[model samples]
Target: MSGGRFRPLAGVLAATAVALTGTRVSAIALPWYVLGTTGSAAWTGVVAFAEMVPYVLVKALTGPLVDRVGPRRISLAADVVSAVAAGAVVLLDALGALPLGALIALVVVIGAGRGPGDLAKEIMIPEAAGRAGMPLERATGLMGVTERLAQTVGPAAGGAVVGLFGALPSLGLSAVFFALGSMVVGLALPRGMGHSAPAPADKLGSGSGSGSAPEFGSGSGSESESGERVTPAPRRGAGSEEGYWRRFGEGMAFLRGEPLLLTVIAMVCVTNLLDAAFGQVLGPVWAKESGHGPVLLGLCGSVMGLTAVGGSLVAAAVAHRLPRRPVLFAAFLIAGPPRFLFLAFDLPVVAIVAVFAVGGFCGGFLNPILGAVSFERVPRHLLGRVGGLQTSLSHVGVPLGGLLAGAAVTVAGLAPVLLACGAAYVLALGLTGLRPEWREMDRLRARPATARPTADGPVSDGSSGAEGRVGVRE
Candidate 1:
């Protein structure tokens, strides 16, 4: 592909990297800061709950708006909001005026902004992939690589900054990253990239087959090849409650029909919950209890992230050639259980590091496979709403994860809670795997279905009763 074609994808990836790095840094800095200051696990959990609840709720509600307004605009605007909120947290702390309630409120703002911002970036992925003539798996794999690289760098940097200068400085750096991410989306992307998805009635040609990118503006029209401006189809009840609910319902209905997607969401919800518990409560507590402190915590995360980057790079090269089901199953098996077990056992720092490294490598293969499947399944026009709903549902348990973990640890202590969580993780996956819908993971149609409106409802073209290929090579 020409550099022009690839530039949008590059910009999106760059923006995603910068933004995620900041998030990862905050992930470390905030929890450590809370734990250190309050010396209470329950309070730490409360802070996590405050942030993620708003994150899930806002992301769930913003899908239609993202579709109508354009992901690029939403992403840029959201990042700016995040920067300001994060900056406020740092500023308040510097002045020693930061109360617990104030900190929670600021993080809530940050989470609210992040919800749509992250969704917008994800909404751009398929379009970016098409622009570059890249396979979906490769594009998602590259995205995974970018995320892992941020994970690798962010934690280490956060730990160093916090250790050397304090949590305030690390938070200030996070604000800087958020600002940079906004700038990239604003200035680095091609002029015509990350536009709103066309309505069904618009009759615009689908996909990037013509090799023409969408114009970057938020206008309700695009210029056609004949140099005429093609107006968008009028949105029914646009900006009204009826329109938002209708769009939300459409996304929910689409999800309900896809048993495979539903099953994936169910499974992901459990894992995400467990992962949140680990990140927010169990991991930090373990670090403190084991006398490893923030430096060792960062070291473990860095080692895992580095290996995950390598794994993602390999996945980017060859994931399309792999069978989706077996790879996903194996990766989850390796990635989920052992980390908890090792930590629960209070193993030596070296042993914990090794386990994390191995687990992260396997974990890296996950997103590319799942992302490819999701992109292939959903129609392009509904990408924003569907993607947002899927993400929101999958994250439903995240807010509670920390609260549950913290309360469990406070009452029963850390090791027992860790063991129980690991057991629950295994159970959740094993139970979900038995469902017949999981077989669909390896079966995909040649292309995503195109939506066509009928008197009754929207229908998917070329998808009903079609035979599916066994792998994601297309």
Candidate 2:
């Protein structure tokens, strides 16, 4: 890894470690909290919906804010908020004042904070990864690994904390982690590092030699005619003080214009929605009802996390060698059905582990490949907006998934609900309609070695890009 990017890289993982600790603790608590409180499955669903709806909406809406503020600032602020929110939960629980309504509201607050926190953290990585000169695929693959590492370690840790101590301690533990993460990123980043734009002098010279300001819209630094140098923009990819809606439109238009990148996001949305139902809400209920306790649930989480790590390693090692479309399509194809079957059959420990492992493996493969596509397709000028939009779209299914599962569980039972979810995954993954548009994704992973990204940067791919041209994250 390039030394320049290492600090940022560490910042991201540290933030993740903090964030996931909170999520795992919360995840460990969700089903039990609801069941303990109301004793009604329907009410459990409502809480899930309440928590996820805000998370989804906040994530979708915050794209421009992230773009405007810079991911580093956003990331740092989010960590602090997450820490504070988690800390509040511990205090509330301790005072014998915790109620389901208060708990749900607090969760909503945490979820909202998590949305931007996650976006900022993910957006910051590409800049650092780019500086490292790591191949986009390798960088994204490692990102997938980082997520899996958190998933693998976090739940087990949360389980141990909750079991050995209680939810209050677990929440407090999460707070400490997030607080530390905030400190590291807020203080440790080299000032203005990974925020390069072309010097204005280079832009003027390059444009005068060829095109105009419209063509050189981004990378807007200027050298003074009188020999004084102007300061560069504080954040990379920010445009002139354009109207937020207009800027939002432009981001949307960018994604609409990119067919393959758009497809990847759509695929992610579908899978995310279904998985949200299967993995997020229903799965926990199933585990709890299956005569297995929180410890078993924790074991299940650990297995999935470990397998996801393996999958990330596999993708990192071999992804660049494969064609992008097929790799991506195959990953989605493998991810969905295993969970349904695993639960449908009520498999033994080894079997259950195998099912989750496969799901995690496929999920691990999905992120890097999808991330590579996202990072490569969008210009540096719109990274934050695109990243935010991608995240928003990817998470769109969550609330609905939780709601749908809530209703479905009452009618079809959890096993049948899972089976239905598996079908939904296959449908979404298959809808991309494999085409010539995304055929060369791997080949385009880096701007052709011969041609540098021009001062103006690359335009959307002529035909395909126009279709999915809105908010295509890079």
Whose TM-score is greatest here? 1
**Per-candidate local distance difference test:** 0.71, 0.59
Candidate 1 residues 1-474, lDDT tens each? 578888788989999889978887887888889998999998889898888898888988888888767789899999999999999998888899999999999999999998888888866776777688775556666766777787788888888888888888898898999999999998877654656334443222222111111332222234466433333443553433346777777677766766776777778777778878888888889988988887888778778788877776777677777877788778777777777777988577788888888877877677666665564455555666776777777778888988888888999999999899889878987998899987665545322222221100111000000000111100
> lDDT winner among the candidates?
1
TM-score of 2: 0.81
* Candidate 1, lDDT over the whole model: 0.71
Which consecutive 10 residues in model 2 have the weakest lDDT in total?
Answer: 458-467
Cα displacement (angstroms), candidate 2, residue 355, comes to: 1.5
Report the C-alpha lDDT of model 2 over 375-428, residue by residue, as the tens digit. Answer: 444544555566567667756766676677777887778877777777766776
Instruction: Estimate the TM-score for candidate 1.
Output: 0.84
Cα TM-score per model: 0.84, 0.81
